[model samples]
Target: MIDPRTPVLVGVAQFVDRDSLSADALSPLDLLAAVSGAALADSGGRGVVVDTLAVVRLFADSSPAFRSPFGSYANLPKSLAARLGQAPRRTIYGPVGGNTPQLLVNLLAESIRSGASDVALIAGGEALRTQARAQKMGLALDWSEDPGGEPETLGPETRLVSAHEVAHGIAMPTAVYPLFESALAAHYGDDPLAHRRRIGALMAGFTRVAAANSYAALPVERTADELITPTDDNRYIAYPYTKYLCSNMFVDQAAALLLMSTAAADAAGVPVSARVYLHGSADVHDMILVSQRLDYHSSPAIRAGAAQALAQAGIGVAELDHIDLYSCFPVAVEIAADMIGLAHDDPRGLTLTGGLPYFGGPGNAYSLHAIAEMAARCHAAPGSKGLVFANGGYLTKHSFGVYSTDHPANPARIDPTLLQAALDAAESPPFVESPAGAGTVEAITIPHERGIHGPATVIVRLDSGHRALAVIDTEAAALIDTQVVGRRVNLTPGHPINHARFE
Candidate 1:
């Protein structure tokens, strides 16, 4: 039996790939209206109006003028109100994070369970490509970024990384992900070449999916060699990751969801077609600094949160008809798969929208696309279930949810904060760089004065050595002239350390 407290997801919508917004092309506001209408329509053409609206970032709409007390994205809350033609009982200009979509849904579900509101809507969009094209074509557009008035005071708990991280070489996504990639390679005792090949094969699967997904931003299938091979067209962005394996954020797309209480859905007469229930959700975060992590190979947040969510939904990985693991890089997918015990080649596939790399990472909101696809899958599969995983701020945080067409057995909502607390207390060890000893050379990323450079490869070690990543410090020099990839090397700590090729 469906628990009385169970919250039903009645509507979902998404948009993608437009060079320009045609007359039929929904403007940001119009897009919101259409999706809201679609959600309500899906809910059996229910007459119910939203009382609460949670507006996630409209990526293409981030104009300097839209800044407000709620930060730059606050305008979404008020703008959604105007578009929907109703006074929201409450409006949230959510904090920035890729996990915002699922987080907002979790908050709305709690509110419904608490009787704080009867119906709510969560929406987000990105039009980076569209705006760029419009400007290049000399079309005048009035996208507002300034949301007038004093900004609301941000809460004390939220912390952004220091400028030093950015000033240094660690701020970029490709750079950041390599920290985990290198660690995982070392942990697994694999040579850089083998690791690169594995990652290439994994991401090629996503590219194949994107080729089939109409909404994919880079909808072209990349061969494993094309993906991992170090060539001018596909250069190494980081040591273990190449350009094709990284997330693609430069795209135009948006997605929205309509969530209503079961009581509200019943009152509106929304049909079975539009209804997907939240069986369970778990939200958690790892330690803030990647350097401070106890274990680089695993994400405790993913393991704990995913377990809790699946347990709450009363289902196992094998039973889920659809699964959408976050795929910003191969490590994200590998960590998720390892934690959840899903086969890398599971027939269900790892993503519902190709993945962030091909589907496009809309900053912190790409998972919204995943959730939308998962909802559609539930609709298509009828009694089956779906899972959506979202990551935020450098894999530092994670949230997982399970949904189904069946009524939820346990109607109560578990506090995600409790899960976050557990993660906070979990112990992790510090990652210490190894002092050079005899070992094999593997793939490496070297920072240069101009740009990040590499032609990384696998190398064997001599004299009871250890394998470690290496980079040659040079000024835009040729790859062959650079220090050895196959020769033995001394890694003495000194000026920029050393990777001298031993005869």
Candidate 2:
């Protein structure tokens, strides 16, 4: 007999509000409450005696300046609990990261497996689209609520980027991901045109999935040619990345999951058909700084985490009937596919609910939507297994999960610290804050603003073998249409930033 404390996902739900112009558009809290109720209903009833209410922190909550124009909440988890009429014994507000959803699920599953908790609810939502609409229309929305209570916070609050990266203007995802893209292209030996077609084809598959998904924020499908060939609408955001290739974060979406022990599910009268077991799960992180990474084209943490999770499940990637690799960018999917040993043209498809770019990134909660979709698919095709990969930061954090309707013989086990320690032990290249003299360009990116050329950022390997960043003017950026890797460049350290000139 299986252990009574074995954790199982009872129900899942996803919501997307595209009618941003409506006055009745839901706030983030409203979306959370709605999805929470829907998820409970999906489990066949309402109250399940939730012991813990955990929330994935929103992107808007990262800074006070980005607070919703409607209003703000003091205690987000507690406020959400009041809306759901749930007074969980413990409320948890998770740290900011796209990986938080899956990480929280893994942690909560362990808690339930150990009999620390019986039932838990994990939910997250983003109303960025609605907020943007409100701001554009100069409309006032009163969503302010002060539900008093300090909930327990999960994960540390640390800056995602390093000081050196920030000083070189490589702070945001837009800038940082392109650096990886350049490196990946060079690693694959693909020319500018060939690389564009390759990624465009990959993302086109995701768009087709989104076109079929009713809850997708942008459901329109496009051909690979249309995706790669830049038009007035699909202008270049960064070198090798068109606007359509980026994750669509301006979306009003929410997702939630209801997790409980098998004993609790049975006690609640949940049908066996409605249960989806998490057979395996693991979380790990790569080197924090991109400059210090041993290889920009691949991620060690992803490979170890995927292998560990599959090992715990006593299965391999071939056994998975479905998969949803995080697709914030083409490189993210490519790197994950390589590490997980999955083919780009795998018959099973790379995503369930489209991908972050086509379906809507929805801040850090994007993977929650993927998890919800995977659960529904598993329930529909009983006995089949699915894998979901969640990524946070710049491929810096990773979490993997394998799910199936059939229960696992062995209990779920995960040791993220072990993998993290291994990654930490790996030697990293030295990063130079300032450098003089000649260097070779390791990677380069030229981002565009409003369809116009912008500054070019380059990662240069100095004569001493240390990596440093330099910015170039648009005049120099135009000359780097082809591969810039191995191109000789002269670096001049400046007060605010460093300048590089191609030789």
Candidate 3:
């Protein structure tokens, strides 16, 4: 018999608002309330009782660029709950990271397993598409609110980017992710042009998946060549990455999930067919800074997290019937698939809600949609197992969960603290902030802003057996056209940022 305290997901709801624009656009808060209410109603009326309510961090609150101009909420979680007429004993405001959704699941599962929470209502949404429209058209919006009462914050509020990275022009995901792709391209021994086509072909599969998903923002199917080749519509955002290849955060989307203990679900009269068990779950983080990592092409965190989650489920990657690896960029999916031992072209497929790029990247809440999708797939397949892998902070944080509809026995799980410590203790070279000498280029990114290529950002391994981040302030054309990984570059230490040039 399954443990009474075992947590199971009973309801999920997703929404995509494509029609609204400017002032008519629903705010993130509005979307959150609608989806949360829908999720609870999906759990069979008032059958499920929510003792805890968690809200994923919004894009506006998560980043400076997306900061809401119409004022702010004093208590976002409570703001959302009040709309549902709920006064949950515990209200949580999630931290900044795409890993948060799955992280919240693993955390709430532990809570339900311990009998701390009978049921939980978790929800979040993004209205950047609307926000952008308002800003560009000089329209007015009022997103401010004060729901009253303080809600506890969830997860770490750690800084996502370091000052050194900023100095080197590695300011955002678009710029940072290409560092990994460049290294991956070199590792694959493909020339600049071939590697572009190779990744283009890989992401073309995602576009096809998106075409079938009603919730997908860019639901239009695109060819491999169409994705890679730049034009007026598909311009290169950063080096080796076109606009189509990156995550589309500018979306008006929302999703909600309901989790309850088996006892609570049974008491709520939830159908057995509707319940999905959390068979395994784990969360892990790599060296917080990209500069501190040992390399750019791979992720130890993903390898460890995937292994641990599968171990807890008493299965292997091969045993999973369905899968969705976070696809913020092509490199993220490639590295995660490699780490988890799944083939790039696995017959079962790699995404559930298409991917972040196609389905829609709702800031820190993208994986929530992935989880909701995974639960639906589990219900459809009954005993079939599904896995959702969520990534955050430039592939720095990872969360994994295994799901199935059948009553599950205790599988196995390592103490997360123990796993984390081992990962933290992994051998890493010293990080050098200043450098002056010959260095081997480990990765290269020539960012494009406003339709023009840039002074390149380069990650280098100095002769001192340490890593240094530097910039090439000129000759944007040469760097963009050629493969620079493994090539020698000379560094000249400068104020604010160091400079690098081909030897």
TM-score winner: 3
What do the candidate models score in CA lDDT, each in turn?
A: 0.68, 0.86, 0.88
Question: Model 3, residue 145: what's the lDDT?
Answer: 91
Model 1 agreement with the true structure over 11-69: per-residue lDDT tens digits: 88777764544423334555566666666566674467888887765543333432222
| TM-scores of the candidates in the order shown | 0.82, 0.97, 0.98
Clashes of each: 16, 0, 1
> lDDT by residue for model 3 over 1-503, one digit each (tens)?
77788898999999998885746678888999989988988777354567999999997888888788877888899888888888789999998889999999888888888778988988988988888888888988888999678889864598877988898987799999999999998988988899998888888999998999988887988899998988888888997998989999999999999999888888888888788988888999999888888788889989999999988888888889989999999999999998999888888999988888889998899998998889888888889998999999989999999999977666334579988999899887788888989989999898898669878899999988988989976588877759799999889988889998888
The superposed Cα distance between candidate 1 and the true structure at residue 131, in angstroms, equals: 2.9
After TM-score superposition, what is the CA distance of residue 225 in candidate 3 from its true location, in Å? 0.5
Q: State candidate 2's TM-score.
A: 0.97
Candidate 3 to truth, TM: 0.98
Candidate closer to the true structure by TM-score (higher is better), 2 or 3 = 3
- For lDDT, candidate 1 versus 2, the one ahead is 2
RMSD to native, candidate 2: 1.4
